[model samples]
Target: MTLSYRVLIALLTPLIFIYLWVRGARAPEYRKRWSERLALQTVPVQARDGIVIHCVSVGETVAARGLIEDILRSYPQLPVTLTAMTPTAAELAQKLFADRVYHYYLPIDTRGAMARFIEKFAPRCVLILETELWPNLLAEAKRHGAQVMLVNARLSAKSLRSYQRFSWLLGPIWSALDLVICQHVDSERRFQQLGVARERTVVRGNLKFDCQVPAATTRAAKQWRTELARPILVAASTHQGEDAIILDAFARLIQAVPELLLIIVPRHPERFREVTSAAQQRFSTLTRSSGQTVSASDQVLIGDTMGELLFWYAAADIAFVGGSLIPRGGHNPLEPIATKTPIISGRHVFNFQPLFDRLTDVNGVRLVDDAEQLAEQCLQLLQQPVQGQTMAAVASEEFAAEHGATARVLADIQGLFPPPNGQARTLKMILTSNPNAATEIWFDDNLATAVSDDYFAPSFWRQKGQIIGSATGRASAWFIQHQPQNMLLRHYYRGGLVGKFNRDRFAREAIVKSRAMAEFSLLLQLRELGLPVPQPIAARYQRAPIWGYRADILVAVIADSQDVFKLLLQRSLTAAEWQSVGATIRQLHQAGVYHSDLNCHNIMLDQAGKVWLVDFDKCGFRTEGEWQQANLQRLLRSLLKEQGKAEQSQQLFHWQQTTDWPHLLQGYEQA
Candidate 1:
């Protein structure tokens, strides 16, 4: 299927160029940057080893603004390359980001073009917005070992059926996606049906809900409203067929309420003149770009300018989101919802059907079938100001409830690219000084409060009546109820001959290189790689005496779990359970992690039988080599030693060298 796809695309390359040339006749911007579209231009130095984000057009570019800006702020050292398929989206990106991002036209999806693109940019990760799944683009990116993620992804029922029809070609491509951050659960389910693994898909809510309405935009809207002092209806992002219906509705609206003004904004730039002409035939109209004041005689205002859709929604008493009156799947209604403006739309909003349906259920949006219904809904809202205000308030509340998607997305992105090995802090980790003991503490800000020396002391938790339990190991570990979570606190102690003299103190070194700090940092990196390791809460290094320091770490405790050694002593594990344990170890090895001590004592199983590895006292990342196999052999030795002890004690041992080991090896090899 892929071979045939490649051949088909190759044959259509000339026609694609001709289509671009034809489009350039009406929109000349398409004529420029032909080299970029063909992947023939030189790659910018700053863009290498960075991130690439592809937004198909203006709407996607706008939807991705918050995410792109957050990525730039979070990883300033890494450059970002923004690609768009249309001139409008490219122009918007350039205008919004300026030189902070490198802008390029996404090349045509020929194998050669995509290969050149992947080779040139060498992006560490590729983020595709919405449903723009180009097979060659995905293939080349994966071929070069770049993580490919689908951001703000959505799939309508219609789109799902269409994709299913071509499953032979798209199945592998969809299944290969590293992650799909969906806007809705419905989309996630559709993607799963189309072959995306359930574990790889997550519902992050809609990125559009996280869109911010700037204070300056609000002030401008207020000023415009005060000047007009009349009820206004904003028909925003109107498609061709929808504009005629909206204009017809406006004509009826004026007969009942003569003072109401209508502002219509078309979705595409080329239709601005056409929409303006259609509006003028029925009523006195003024264009926004003309710099002419809208008089009482002029009942229609044409919003032909760019980047002011939010402003229009904010200034209106009622907003009718366009594209739904036709089969264009509606523009996003969250903009008006953000501005606290009542919304009306047609029933063909399959693109955002879930959101619209929820809004309709809450009386936040009114669905109209045609010009008559659109006019009736507009007149009702315009005549009854309190009703419109109530709807707006409801919609605003719903919008507010969904506002943290940008932060969630940023958190996930942080997980994708952990900081280099020696960096002191992850993006969410914070450092603070403990004045009591002259200590430095590194903690995850999301989990911990202000850290002090007392946090490491069991006496503090005991005094607070928060200590829950204690475990005896080479040293002692205290488990405590830490406000919102259960945490395990362990004080560092030397083992072997070294432990005889210096049990708790060691030579002073850089705080980040201390045993507690190193393990905490390694756990953070491992978690980012999606490993099943304990979450690091906090790590502290306290100055003890001359040239020495005492270290301690606090980590979240896995609930309802027992060590594999203990579980095995209790009863025999199924072959499937053994296979899962092997797969978990293989996953860690694949991430280039060296577990340092991979023994039965360190491996655990939760209530659900999920495998987890713990105790990273001396573990760190290493280049792939024989060490991975050696780590497995060490586990095997531990199992044999335990079996020998069990035999000597006349106890039942669950593991068999020939049977269990083979299952583990099969899982490891397959994984």
Candidate 2:
């Protein structure tokens, strides 16, 4: 799925570039900030744990306002990064949120870009408003342990038909979503058909209906309206073809009401100048961008500003939402409801059909087909203020009825992380394979990728220190410093006759329970049993042909520690130091943890006089007492092996000349 999608996106990038170039010519905003679109901004995306909310444009951004506030109030300590896809929406997000969040332009939905985006943000959960379902974005987000959700989600029938054509591609993507909060039952059913589990799909009311009109914007609207004559009519978010219909209707309405003023606000910034140029040719026009004082003689005003949609809705007595006038579905209808402004739209509001139905039922929205019908409705609404006021009030009431969803949304999000022992909860992940690759992994869910043999590569760590290589050809290890502590990364290998032919591969029997995993488990058990040991960070293995395998494990390096073998050659061991070694071994045997290859090199003592055991490859738990004596015999043989090879010195306790074994035995037997 990723490869297929990548190829399509790659092939279409040139066309996409051309589209952006054409739009950039009209709207410099699109071209001026290329770094933001590519996620190359200087500011860091995010860090620590928090939620990220993605809103596609101004309409969806407004709908997410209440939900964002809810999340902030609930989890005050967590960081928030709000992202937008377009410049207008990004600007509006800053105005609405101010310093409340870290804001950015959402990156292009390619795997590399998405991976970098996810890595930078490191978000614990991601909330996407409405239906911005980018497959690679979701997949990469899940790979990094983000719980993705679609809020105020709706799947239009048109979208459903299109998505069905790529069911195989989309099904897995839909299944990866942690939650789908839909606006209606129809959308919920549609999502279920597209492979969303029923348990994860929820029916939540439209958040747009729950939005409130800003008091500051309303006050500004009143101040702006004082300069204009009575009976102001606004054609808000007018699309290209719809502007012609609106201008025609306004031309007729002006003759019937001489005091009326028409306002045309194009939906996009690029069209502002185009609409302004076209409107100025026939009408006495005033534009917000020109900073001209309004006059009763001025027939039309072009709304060429930003972050003032609600202000325009509040400034007028009636509004015709634009896209409906043409076949372009429709813009959000609920924008005017918050301001108690009457709405007039065309019959083709398929994008907001369900919302239009509810408004029509309450007699709050009037629908018209052509310019003449639109003029007629505007004339009547202006003539009968009482009827128009009643409709506006109902629209605001309809908005209030959907008010409680924010709290409900907050509740469900809170349920995702319950406060337990005053710790931030981590996601639970079971052992699972990467479907895109050929490997398996087990770890805490937050990591971006499964820990595997290749994970030990120096590139994986942020800083790989010096790699110390041993003279022996049996095995290899690297030293690196990651967060929290330094780590030792070692690849497992066999020695002696078996190693000559097999090299790096371990026996096939250990495939199910690989040598690395066995050692990792043994270390965990030893630590749990109160034995001193290095922390086992992660372990993994890759299979070879014939089921043979190579394995690796990363363990925290103990600070200020040296092996007993090195310490022995430095000075003659005191009786207390020898006794401490015995007690350490006694503790391991008493806890039923057996070290299969314990020797002088495997035991270490820190500067503060703490003893630790290391290297548990091919080691595990045992119930019998027979292995205890055998382990001691093995250690005795290892000591003699080292003694025969080393040159004797009076400063060291040579195994041939000392009673060190009797002292060790004395401490072991007494304990």
Candidate 3:
């Protein structure tokens, strides 16, 4: 731990306690177990060797509930301890898993407290929800040989900047993690920027999206359908100032349609009474907690109950999710989406921007600004039932589309355990980095280079013989014939948006993050898994004075082989050949390989019809799920793109539909 951090924690520890005490004034649960929060009340003589999961607050508690339940259901043999930073989280966790999980208040991050907590749990693994960067807690757990994982992780730009300021202090804490399950590609990028290795980070999607509304919630929603007025609007999770604007909008909407009902759910329970008093001045209102049934005569409903936001959405014809109206980062839309209720969102939704983007792009969500715009938008959805239904269908479809991430994450959890047959490799390598810059080169211990670091450079390959040339529409590689082995040397070239600026430039990165170096390491792992792939001989890179670098990797080539793309144009692939292709890819998938750019050209066939996958650049292992279908779809698209130019090419590909496609899918299914 950094001395400055320790000193800061020491200075602020009293204020932290004060803050907890103040919170306890509103909700006494925070005061009930003060000792547990300090790690002073634990008296267990023996530690439980299972898993410990930490959730920071209510949002995190909700997100992790599914994952904890999954762990209990799937791996009931191992004990579990759940810890929360806030009393609300602790109470919710206990309620969710009262007998199933051991629930406790997480201790502060002092070294002694963290060490004591670690010792008490003696957890086999520590899985923390979201981006909680408790340095002492993580470091202590890791020191005790616990596998530390950051699950459903993400970082906003603001958070990233804040973390970068103290990166020197926190880099080691991040490096201590054995695995990091990121929410998306962007989160993976941010984590990588923060000194995380590509191998350890996996984009497993956000678990919040994986949540299912309780069957009780769905069943209760149905009963609410008959009570509310037509075109009823729910402004769920409304913050301080947002209620007035939504109420104003509802007032205007009421003018357009005389019988409209608006149910406003304030975000905090403490504000429920205050908001209800203010709202009653302009409309006929009733509080949800009053044990009074709402009717068409009631122009407004104050949702004062805790955690029935779903039922309110289900009761309404239209739902306007509130935190979006003001500066408060938006609440989740999944609750409304769960019931296929039409949604109206205010312009701001940075918290779940990607989710909102997917919704609004398809008109699944109607974005509005202040009172008038919200009134107009809500009126539009209310009047046009077809439009509402279409938006609702697409919104539900979009939500359904994000579902498979849970299974993929579970696969990653299973991957944490060692192989049944002890097939894991004890990989050791030689690594050297530039002192002047953040660049590194890695090579297998058995391999070494006599040439300079530029051995894999283009000039070196051009001076030697070349099998692949520029005319192939890819001037990226050259096949070299050597005494001991034939190797394919590929110069790293950028793809996508960044490539336009500099095709061969990469921001000088750490040892494990270098594209060429990471790929080389992965190929070694793939080869050991007995997959048909090239052997990596050497990899190296050169960093510039300031930033950006070029790199390359040399892998032993498969001789006397032709890519499936090339083979297809020459002749139709036999059914056996197609089956072999499916079986070959499945072998890698079973070993947890995620070929990011799986294409017909990547798969090769030799004289004996043996198949091998090559060009494993920008690829790594991922928890397998819908991605398998996506991979197949990408290969199919690649084949069509490659062959669509001519009927002769088409006939060769189309011929396989009857024989090749069927057997290929069958082989995959069998595997």
Candidate 4:
């Protein structure tokens, strides 16, 4: 007891002091941003032929415990695991089941852990208790073939009201659940209002009833009743501001029942000191169940320990649940009912609503609107033991009748096993920056794949498939269907801007028309003469525009050739190779197709070193003067951009004039 209280004090002392200090201190401006500290390490676990259950906290775990145990017993051959997000819940689960069930801390819901965990635990079925629906978890689970179900579900009215605020993000996630077993009709209705389809949801009653009430729990209550000299009124699960309300009510009640003793239990154990301090300040005489005594003038008594709540209920004449008076969802009233104790709760009984409604329907519980009414109700109940006993008896009967929901849920799940025959083909489409830099294929059920960061650069792939390359940003190349298919995917800004200067205002419409005109005109002229050029199979210029409206161009692959630049840059060219290369260029220019901004990288070479003009988006008519000079200048600029020396480039220009250029002009003028 000392160690627990000390631990509580150690945990809460700083929080209380910090709260007080901050309240009095000048505060900094509030910023609307997520702090980096909030990130969680989410890990995914793979469960092959195993049942994976997620229960958030103590209450959900307790309710789901029976169902988990039943599955283990029924399917002895199958493996099962449980995951919890909180330390206390994990500790409780560990203590409850020990080594009987596999227990692990649930990783934060993040892309990395989620993918890895799914790969680790290829669960056959995933049972999520209550309303702990996380978006990434749900989506990943569905992607990995795990059938998901929410069992023993209950959505409070307050929670439902809050869900309405985020319905857009919440709706699709809720819809993803394959099945939801609600604890009450009201809970089912609330879920439906939040967009949970009725077809997927069914009411299975609260599983808490299915749990066997401990014998010693009842005996301890009897012992408490025998030990208390005065009539005891229990204020259970009270919040911070609520203890004062309970004290105000108790002050009034003590006037009527002079021997009245107030037993106050806080909702969170960490608040024990704050509650006890308040109690000490209010009462002249107070006593704790741990044997600390106070004078009769004292009005408040703190029941701060856990695993003693049942004993407190047994010792009390009437129980008032907290949070209801303060607008927070009322704490569980079932605890008091399970011990055959009469209950008086405030109007905000949203938490244990279904149980409260059942109790009210059977005259098993009393509801008070405020502190005054609570005091009056407690006075009346304490004065008349017969009335309290009758109500307590009714509550016990209702608790017993509501049992078996766990068994029903388990039985239904049993029939859902052995999934339909036949497996479908796995086809995955991943949206990533670059396909070349990827380490491994993202073909896992969880879609756990990564792309390389290097593919995000701009200038590296603008030129390809030609001996003379064009540095027209408007025409770029990429791998399509994972092959080197030159495409004008994103022309200028969108694709059709003619100059780098006009990139800011590039239009998709102009790009499409220009690309089609250039490619088609070249194709028609080349095919007429029966010269070598890639046959244009199909073309699309007015489809799928980018930032601007420019559309991308795609073409089919041509076979049996090496790009001329790759062939020529490596070795000495033969006479036949030189003839074919020079002849192709002459035929193209004579055919009135002069490639604007042509550099060596733009031409393709067959095994025989035959050259072909490609990347027609920058090709222009072979007219005299500045248009021809501009094309030559653009070609020189591209060569310089590749770090070619001014002297070698001058030699390439000299070759263009004396050899290839004159030959091309002779061939063209003669033709």
- Winning candidate number (lDDT): 1
Error of 3 at 499 (Å): 76
lDDT of 3 by residue, 258-365 (tens): 888788888766577778988889889899889988776888889876556667887778988888988887878877887789998988898888789999787799
Per-residue lDDT over 562-606 for candidate 4, one digit per residue giving the tens place of the 0 to 100 score: 554455345434545555555666566555566764665666676
Worst 10 residues of 3 by lDDT: 418-427
Candidate 2 RMSD to the real structure: 12.9
lDDT of 2 by residue, 1-671 (tens): 45788777667766765777788898877776666565555543123346789999988888888888877677665668888878788888788888878888888776776776776666778999988988878988887767898888989778888898886554468877889988889999998988899999988777776777777888888988886647799998888888878888888998999788888989898899889888888789889878888887888999888777888899999988888978988888777887888999998888778789988999999999999999999999999988889998987786676777777776777777532222332211123343233344443233224555445575555344345432122455666655566578777777889878877886664332578756665564466446898877766666676667677777878887878777877766667777787888888888777788888878889988878888888786677689998888878887877776675432443454258887777767766
For all predictions, the C-alpha RMSD in Å is 14.4, 12.9, 23.2, 20.6
Superposed by TM-score, candidate 2 places the C-alpha of residue 631 at a distance from the truth, in angstroms, of 22
User: Candidate 4, TM-score vs. the true structure?
Assistant: 0.49
Error of 4 at 667 (Å): 71
Candidate 4 CA-lDDT value: 0.61
Q: The CA-based lDDT of model 1 is what? A: 0.86
Question: lDDT order of candidates, best first?
Answer: 1, 3, 2, 4
TM-score of 2: 0.64
Alpha carbon lDDT of each predicted model: 0.86, 0.76, 0.76, 0.61
Q: Highest TM-score: give the candidate number.
A: 2
> How many pairs of residues in model 4 come into backbone collision?
30
